[model samples]
Target chain A: MARTFEFHGGVYPPERKQRSQGPVRHAMLPGRVVLHLDQHAGRPAFATVAVGDSVKVGTPIARCDGMISAALHASISGQVTQVDRHTITIDSDGLDAWQRLTPLEWRTASAEERLTRLEHSGVVGLGGAGFPTHIKARVSERQRIDTLVVNAAECEPYITVDDLTLRQYTSDVLEGAQLIASLCGAKQIVVGIEDNKPEAISALRQAMAESQPLSVTVSVIATRYPSGGERQLIKTLLDRDVPDKGLPADIGVLCQNPGTLLAALRSVRDGEPLVERLVTLTGEAIADPGNRWVRIGTPMAALLDEAGLNRAALHQLIEGGPMMGTPLADLEGVVTKTTNCLIAATRKELPPAPPESPCIRCGACEEACPANLLPQQLHWYARAKDDAKLAHYRLFDCIECNACSYVCPSHIPLVADYRHAKTRLRHQQLETAKAEHAKHRFEWRQARLDREEAEKQARRQARLARQSTQQTDSQGASPQADLRSLRIAQTAAKAAVRKAEKNLARAAQQDPQQSHDDLETQLATAKENLQAAEARLAEARSAGEPQETP
Target chain B: MSDAFSIISLLSAVAVLTALGVGFGALLGAVSERFKGDESSLVEQIDTLLPQTQCGQCGYPGCRPYAEAINQGDAINKCPPGGDATITALADLLGRTPEPLDGEAPSEDLVAFIREDECIGCTKCIQACPVDAIIGAAKQMHTVIEDECTGCDLCLEPCPVDCIDMLPRSTPLAQWQPVTYPHQMIASDRRASMEMPHGTHL
Candidate 1:
């Protein structure tokens, strides 16, 4: 496919990729593995095995809660040792032998049976999308899927595990792609590789020719950072722009990373859950830099040591690619399901910063931005802390791709400004929610008071009527008798008024009122309500609970 | 006889005008170039606004390098920092229409504040900062120059500080731009939160 649109805002840094581009080798199992619960974007996995339980390699240690989370398995045979809020650390001690844990003998299951076994296994998309593979398989079964795009575009620099996977285990990667296509019932399969990895592509092509039909095709992508981004890759290969918030499925396309495909093949055929992953540990400062097929939950520091990168001279330990990666502080943090690369660099490989100066309105950032955004304008509004203007400009849609910052001549951290503004806006939203909640409570309280006042008025009217009837019967012609009863009723009403006054006073003390006028008005209404209620009660006594007063 | 006379008159007039025009053009070109000084300084100033990750997301090799291209009559809105804020600033500087900064950077309102506690003394942030604003060591705490910080936030991502939080700058009545100082002060700190680029300058 030809290059489509003018992608502005790009940087061409020194390609230090050869550091980890060699053959992918497997690292020996470590003594301990710390599996983080939240290895994916959605909900965390639930541990099926308790802390004291024994686990074997590919053992189902935990299960997925629902569609959002994936199940966890033991990468190595071990004993459940520790469980924290978000991670579980297992100690590897026994069972060095590769033995299948499934007593049901899942390997012998048919293709349909394999799909069933996978659902029970709780396998998810290990391609970093973390979508449950069973769901994808099931969805594919319903529709006539045209193609299965196997994303080998490990476009993020210093990440060549997929390349190594293709070179060393070419058969595995291809077989997995075929199985996924057959399972999903797709008509065609395309394994997208960035042009830089020609050897891997050739190896994959050779492997596909032996067993499967020519349905499996190898396509090369331009070597650009984030070329492996699902949407970007889809756009690059298919010339289709998946809507900003749309999925590939919406456009009748399905994409999966090479690593994720291999995992799916292993899970369906072997009845294995996602337990191990290929991690690329390389950087400039690293002493031994290459790709390592490590068990999930291995501490980054341990892998660093294996890669010969010590924590001493290291300047930064970033998870994933330099372009769109999270900077991790402690090297001791465990690798999760999505971690593809751990980049540790020195000052030389990644140079030290220059002093920041004022912006001179140079347009280089705009020209480099791939998304075609005006990075300069974003910087201006962000610097001024004008969040509203930022929102109006669709700040939320920014991919945080770092294109603007990379192209800026002023060394302005444009992305950082955008992030800060978003976070602050989120904080503002929470504050607003809290205030509205309080207002709702006040409105509820006011409604209750109104209802109680109306009830009291009805009772007061009934009581007065009853008193009049009782006076007529007791003192046929005696005005003096009626006078005495009226005085008694008046005294009772006065006491009721006092009680109402006391209740109002108590409420006032509990919550101080700044508007005395408002309080006075409320107090006056309460008193009037109490007076009417007392009159009704007096009448009710005289007439013995008078008939409903209209 | 008439044709010959007309041709000679026209030739003489054209020759005189051509000489004067060439002389004026040459003089103006010489004056402009002499006063322009070096364009590099302007590029250097623009480079400071970039984060300097050299990720090429902006289509340039690095931040400073992009600035040079900008001084050469490139579009001013490319740098995300000079986004809307940068555009307005550029308009103020060069007199142009202020366009909104592009939305290429997702959720662009983030700021980088070093989490002092989590800092591991790695000077990655300092090195990665296109502008050497972060000050710390291979294993010491780093501090940001608040006054000097362009608020471009490039330093945050490289911070081993998990600490470098991109806190959005809060706007108050005082912070509004096209900034008017020592003049009329808007009452109510309920300032408009806009998506502008870095720089406290109006």
Candidate 2:
């Protein structure tokens, strides 16, 4: 028995995992599948196929967008029906045809080749995070990893997918772990699981004995809720705390989910992409409560119907365990890589939460928190929307395990508040970054405008100086004097024309019949004189000689 | 003999006091010179707090000018684009009381959109944009770089053909956030009422 360490705070909820204890079964193929572009944690994959394109199972439908993203493959042999911004829907033709890459010998293959194969396989962390697995494995380039931790704790009650995977494919899981260990150059591998899963523990132990060359050990700890969390499991197994806002890699450790390891093995050995995963369907409202190999993009309604769902008794449908699962409002929503367990809970089995009351400062939540966070304080800060205080309390360290909420005497939704606060903090950080970018661009634009203005002013000053110097050298009168005389002549002509027009207007108003013709003649003569003076000025200017005011 | 002794003591006291005053004054002047703060950096800090929308809604030419004005005792609540958030941040940095926004706040985040076919190859918007987010040359069709655009709306009036539209920024589906508790409850309630009939088919 490998010794284990204890973490801060944990709660032992009713381990209602007996319902889904049977062997895993393959589910029937659906008539249609809707694959969302963004099933992983990073950038969404860009679609490589159009609406009318024909595709087989394992066909590369979408390519990875960036380093942190995962590629997506078609789960069913079908024709693409709709290609929208969010999802790509395919209608199956009822054939299980496949398009696969040639499998590589991982032992003989270089690390880069194995990584490329993993990238092409679209394997992600099936432990509900859906983080791309290849990026996680590539940590060996920058850091020297010493241990690989296989997370098979399966601590969340009523979710038996990992347990069943370990029981059925123990060697495959162990071999996959070895493959990752070799890739990351880790000398030791540890499988951290709960003692309640005796079957899985025994299977892992038997496999460990058979794999003599690989250094692998099974560490079975007491079953506790949220012990499956990456940080908690690492803490329990190695007594090492992942630094705040740091990753397992920072501590020279790499933690990979069992399902993700199995998927990577299949991708490198069988030339298969991640087309399906083991899903646990169990609740009071389910007639056949067990695990099944459900294809990605299978609709919730179809999967539930296959499990013999009790529609009238089903009050709420959750996508994960009852502790930290999200309730499903749309039955038509399809399952993605992160959908691990489905719980069609009845009203009595999982009743709606009561309305929240003010906190009594009982400190039960603090005692039950697995991450050692002060849930009551976080709740107050979240309610007040005090982002600074929430950050000061280290709100980002919260894993949203719902242990605190479960043990709260007042029935406070502590995890929900923490999730909201975390999202708001992330949003605030993004806004600040954007503001900084905008400030940079604004400053650059201002500097450019100032430079342009300075250049224009310099050019104008140079032209004035050059003109003055040219006039002094070539002519007796400077251009400044010439310009002054021209301005005086033009003003005098404009005043004479105005006087003539006013006189004509006055004569017309007094006695229009007698004096209108005489004033009109005077006005015409003044206009002619003005035109003659402007023509002389223009001729002199065009001749490049100074013009005298008339 | 008593008068001579008293005069000598008074003169000695005056000389000692003058020496102490001169020495302390020299020390104070050196310390003040060495520790003098940069005045422009204060403006830079204030400018960082203000949103760089450059919308001219704050009655200044840009965010930097407004930041300078704020440092020069101008009211901090006049920015509509930065709105209350900027005011609170400025108050925190300047150690002043936060005030309510002085003008109408923008109803939503807006990005400028140009109807391309109606652009008529005019470059008016390109010149009007403060951040140079719009790309075009004279007598060439202009377009807004959506990511670079700060949504200042300074280019709206510059369009000759009235082709520019200030539309609310559209969030991509990938960026859509999950609904929090209160909103989630409301959504479930509405779903229950509407999906009851659909449930029967199952």
Candidate 3:
């Protein structure tokens, strides 16, 4: 083994592997299976099959819906009974029907072919995150992958699925490693296991010896709880520290679970899709405790019944390993592709957690925390809801591995508190983002309103200017001046004509008794004068034409 | 001879005081130069503090313009989308008094949904949009980008056929947080929590 580096703060829990040492058992298919579309990270897949539709084993019920999402397949042949939110319920037909499987010959397959096959196979990080395996298989062209770390460190107490996989499927695991390395352009493959699993180590070594051209190394290190952590494992075997907020790939290494490798191998070599996986069913509450190759979507209740669980004495059921397990409230909850172990415990074997007491300020949590965070200080900041202080302390870095909670003599339920705080923080961030987005939209609206208002004002001003200019051009002179002069001239002409008519009438009256020839002649003259004045007024009105080209 | 000695002492005292003053003044000037920090970057900082709503509630056209205004002595409380939280943050950032919102919270986060049947295939609302969030061509029914809509109500007046209506965008799940909600053991949440084999903190 390469020179190992010392990590800060850890706890040594009693290892109880001897509690269940039976060979791998194959579980019978349950009456039904509930496949969650959100079994892995990223966007949830929408169901492709409707209720009452028949589906067989390896039939894709939901397509991968996102860049970082995985597809869902029917682990058993059955008819879809119900399709709820992000979940598909399939009732078993017991006929063992399956979809067509066209295996890819890994030796001759192209990189793209291998990736597509693995993607459709529905394999993920089986031991931990359950991240889509295909996404991890091909690193960016910018990154040249040189090392592949197969995590066989079953460091978590009471879980031994990887160990069995290493022992039973040794050659297949090696072959899968070879295929993964070739795809990622890796030249060195390191399999990190705890020194305790001697049998698994030897089996892997023997397989490596038989393997022709693959440069594989089995590095046995100290049995530590979180030695299997991607960062910690890399540091232990390679002595290279993965920078903060960085992935193993950042340091030219890609870490994968043994079970994932096996699944990958099966997909490429046998053209088999990942429908089922091995799950470790153990805990003192069960009659039988051992590793089992269980079908995906098998309900927890079914597994408990198979293990002969004492329902009367059951305390709490935990999913995954004890150090980092979630207390499952529903027995009806079905198994997902990521489900690796289920611990149905009684009070005697797994007692209920004690009530939390005040922190004594003892430095035990600091000593046990693998991340080197100040747990007590974090607890204080979390309770106070001090987001900045929490960030300053790197609260997001907490792995929730429960090493702090396990070592705390206060029984403070530290892990639960941290998880709650983290969730709250995430929710707060999302709210802040929405608020920011809303502000942008609102401002944009205001800007539009202002712009429109300005435009309207500008249009009104332009219209006013155009009307004024048109008035000036159309009138022979200024309209006000021309109207004033025309009115004065017309008034004078009317007064003059009226005066002449009055004179003629007077003369006719005076000569009423005598001959009226003189009066008649005067009247005719006055009429002619009036006609000439009217003509002048008409000509003045007609002359007002701005339409005439100057 | 004694009078001459006194005159020499007075000149020496004046020279000592002048030297001390010059030394301290020069030190202060150098310190100021070294730590003077960029002032133009203040615009970006203020912009970040302002909710990027692009809403002209602050009498400015967009968030960037508003940020510029704030830098030039505009009131911090004029944002409606940011409301009091934003005002308080801005005040904290700019070291000013936190004031109440200038107007009723800028209309709630909304998107303009055009009633297609009544829409005369006129793109009036599209022209009215500031962010160009509305997508459609002339004589085509227009739709708003829900995510990009600022809900400024600018589109409502321009639509010839009274077809445009402002509807509230659904509040994000995170915004629906309750007082003192600490991962309560609710029945609905129990089954939904993922099966992370390791610790729950990601």
Candidate 4:
């Protein structure tokens, strides 16, 4: 455990961790809070509470939808104000009354029971990974888990929540670690903390002494940037390499963040779900800065206001560490399970990034990249949108730690370029899939219509053939049907001739001297017309088109 | 005796030369047959370049027919629904110089919207549509299936009531994100930010 393995390139930014000076304070309750549904690293939860519904603290407002999702709870007693696609807003009543999840006795319960409670309580990795704890703690029978590594390395600058949490609840963290170890079925349990945090280390030691039966060991490694990364910490403490693109458990190791451990212990020990978390509120613009146990849905504005921050002096508001935090687009955004730190930086404290200059083909970025990827070449390919080349160089393998951006002499935002390229690539892939789907649907519909049309045309042709064959008898039937039709025609013809003769006679009587010869001609023409019709019927019968008569 | 020997050798040499010529000619013919690719694959390549809208703005019946014509050396700039991008893609595929779209490529995306009130139940449009995207019965009001409609313009002429109109389609809300313009950093902010503590910037 003494021999530490070194990872590749990293930067030594000033560890401004003075925010851990004061005792952990409770943040003032916010009047309103906005909780994002997509707090975890996977699919967002499905909303279980509708607008205008009253919810109490720890009430499940959104349940986990898919295998990778985590359930969301109401952080305070409130009325649901708004529910949008991305977020759920609640107006708090300022009441601290608790209605919690049913807790489980972890000491006596089986691992399955413990896991169910942990998942139902909505406990996730609080080290900013936001991975569901239950999923991580599960040890599949495929791999043998040997060690449970407690990650207490608060390596990022300006984040002290983990440090403070370990100091206050070391015993609880130890118990949580034991619970996770039991679940993972690991024999050896160890805590990996950076040597820089002597207070947290001693506090852990004190707790380990009290909990002798648990028998946990603590390993202290030299503090380094990104050493807090689960992979780096495992490599440093255990000298084991997690397979590329694989988890620590692949190599018989499971790493737990101290905050996650404490949360797990609380979920199991008490009948309380995870509705609040310790967030470090610090930066130059704040009047007072320290770590505080803030309710999960409390808005960043409310917390900053409590820290006596001057918004006018704010050059940038960042969420998480200085190196890897997101620039806040909305200061009113509420905290979630993964919130570890808030940096309210002034222009002087954390200056705005300068406009990028030409790359100058500098190799400093290469030396500073811990993942050892060629950042300059990647940046070029990304700008050119040469996705094929970028993929060939394994662009997705980038951890996006921003060390390359920190070391870039040109002040280029390397990580942002990578993010933009990745987004564009994803969009392109999605568009291609959509186009293929559309093409298939269009082609299938056309084929179906054409087949139907062809079938209909064939049917029409067949009917025409039949009708032409039966031209003499339109019914196209037997000899009896034809003879009967002929008889009807003959009778109609005779009736017509009789009626015409009668009319002629009446006309001659009415005007005695007027055209007696004309009346005679009209009756003669009717008799001749009937003879012509009979001849035509005989001619059609002789043509052999169809025959009903013998 | 020597003259007779010379005549026999000359006859043998000529026979060998004739046999060699016929055998090599046969080998070359076989090679040609073996290497000649199916010309229909070229048609397939051209068809793949088309957007498959089946809109027939290209003066052909469908994308497949247009692709065949292009394979037979037809102009590649006739499609408007496929537009300029399609023209360029076809040119690239065929190794031709990229030309401007013939006539005018529709500058805006269009969707066939049916004005239900003005629809006369003639069903002429339903018969005219190449994609069968219109749904109706004889003497019943017809509606366009917007998702499947290719906006071919053939339906417009047959509509007795002229109820079908091609309107510019709006972008879907799900696909929208805040536009991040590159290289738009403010000068003052840029100046203030260059105050790096070390030679390397954070």
Which candidate has the top score in DockQ? 4
Position A489, candidate 2: lDDT: 74
Ranking by lDDT: 2, 4, 3, 1
On residues A1-550, what C-alpha lDDT tens digit does candidate 3 reach at each position?
A: 4456667777777776766668888887788988888888666776799999999999988888766778788888989999997689999999988885687778888999999988887778898688988878867444778899999988888888899999999999989999999889888888999988888998988898876467888898889878887887888888888887777888999998999999999988887788889998887788888888888888889888988887887766888878886668768688787888887867666655544567899989998888878999998888888889989988988888788888778766677678778888887676556545555444434434544554454455445545756777544342322645656755775676577678767765653334444344444444444444444444444443333445
Docking class of 2: incorrect
- Estimated TM-score for each candidate: 0.57, 0.83, 0.74, 0.74
lDDT of 4 by residue, B1-202 (tens): 9999999999999999999999999999999999997789998888767776777777887778898999899998888777787887788888999888887877776778889878878888877776667898877778988766666677888777778889876554444543445554564554443433212234
Interface RMSD of each: 21.0, 8.3, 7.4, 5.9
DockQ of 4: 0.17
DockQ (CA atoms), all models:
0.01, 0.16, 0.13, 0.17
- Per-residue lDDT over A383-467 for candidate 4, one digit per residue giving the tens place of the 0 to 100 score: 8888789998778878888888888878887887887887777676644544443454444455445445544544554566467
Residue-level error in angstroms, candidate 4, position A37: 2.6
Residues A185-267, candidate 2: write the lDDT tens digits: 89999999999999999999898987635689999998998899999999999999999988899899999989999999999
Q: Model 2: runs farther than 4 Å from truth? A: A450-550, B1-18, B97-101, B174-202
- Stronger candidate by lDDT (1 vs 4): 4
Off by over 4 Å in 1: A1-9, A97-132, A135-145, A182-185, A210-214, A426-550, B1-202
Better of 3 and 4 by DockQ: 4
User: How does the DockQ of candidate 2 come out?
Assistant: 0.16
Residue B92, model 3, lDDT: 91
Interface RMSD of 3: 7.4
Best by lDDT: 2
